[model samples]
Target: MQNEKDIVIKELNAFLQGQYMGIRAYEHLIAKLEDPEIKKEFQSMQQDHRLHAAMVSERIQTLGGMPVNNEGLTGKIQGFISQMMMPESTENIIKMAIKGEDLYGIQLSEEIVKGDLDPESKNMVESIIDTDRRHLDYLKNLVH
Candidate 1:
């Protein structure tokens, strides 16, 4: 039987992990990209993920739970796979980013709809979701 605080902490930590994954994925993509403008945009999105991670970690600490500092095994595996599978083209990278953002947005939406988060956490997640939608839109535009 998990208490409310514990549940909230778990949710926040999961979100934080996702942010870490985003940061890493962006770094990988940015390193492969050649266009200055595209690289700059990816860097900006990566920074946003960093900010999101910090905010979520702070909230988790406020709830008396330790935030996860790394993206965990799943993230590592995914990163490895991406490194092996990713194409060199800018369009392909952007398309991959779009898929990631879309998936993350769905996950965030599911968390919000679950109604387990405290008001502050829910608000924060909502804000993050909005940023993710923008990121998704930007990536889609770059590929299209």
Candidate 2:
């Protein structure tokens, strides 16, 4: 039987892994993109994911939990797919980015609504969720 703190740690670690996955996805996109402006925007978003990963790692450590160092199997599979089948058009790239961000935003929102995290962790997640919304909005704008 897992206690609340342990469950929270597990959830946080999962979120951290998701951040790493986002970073990798952005990297794959940036490498494949031909446009300098879009690549720059993706790089910025990737940096934001890095910052989010750092914050989540710090909170996990503060809770006496070990942070995951890698993105795990799902990330690898997603990376593989991105490398093999990513679209060539700028609009398609932006749409893909928006989809990823939207999914992440939904995941983060679900975590908040779950009420499983401690106050500090919840606050950090809320901050990340706000940034995710901005990312989604930016990508959506690029598609319009």
Q: Candidate 2's residue-wise lDDT over 58-93, tens digit each?
A: 989989899998788987887787678788888888
Report every candidate's CA lDDT: 0.86, 0.84
**lDDT at 15 for candidate 1?**
79
Ten contiguous residues with the weakest lDDT in model 1 = 104-113
Clashes of 2: 0
lDDT of model 1 at position 21: 89
Q: What are the per-model numbers of colliding residue pairs?
A: 0, 0
Instruction: Report the error of model 1 at residue 26, Å.
Output: 0.4
lDDT at 60 for candidate 2? 90
lDDT winner: 1
**After superposing candidate 2, which stretches have Cα over 4 Å from the reference?**
112-115
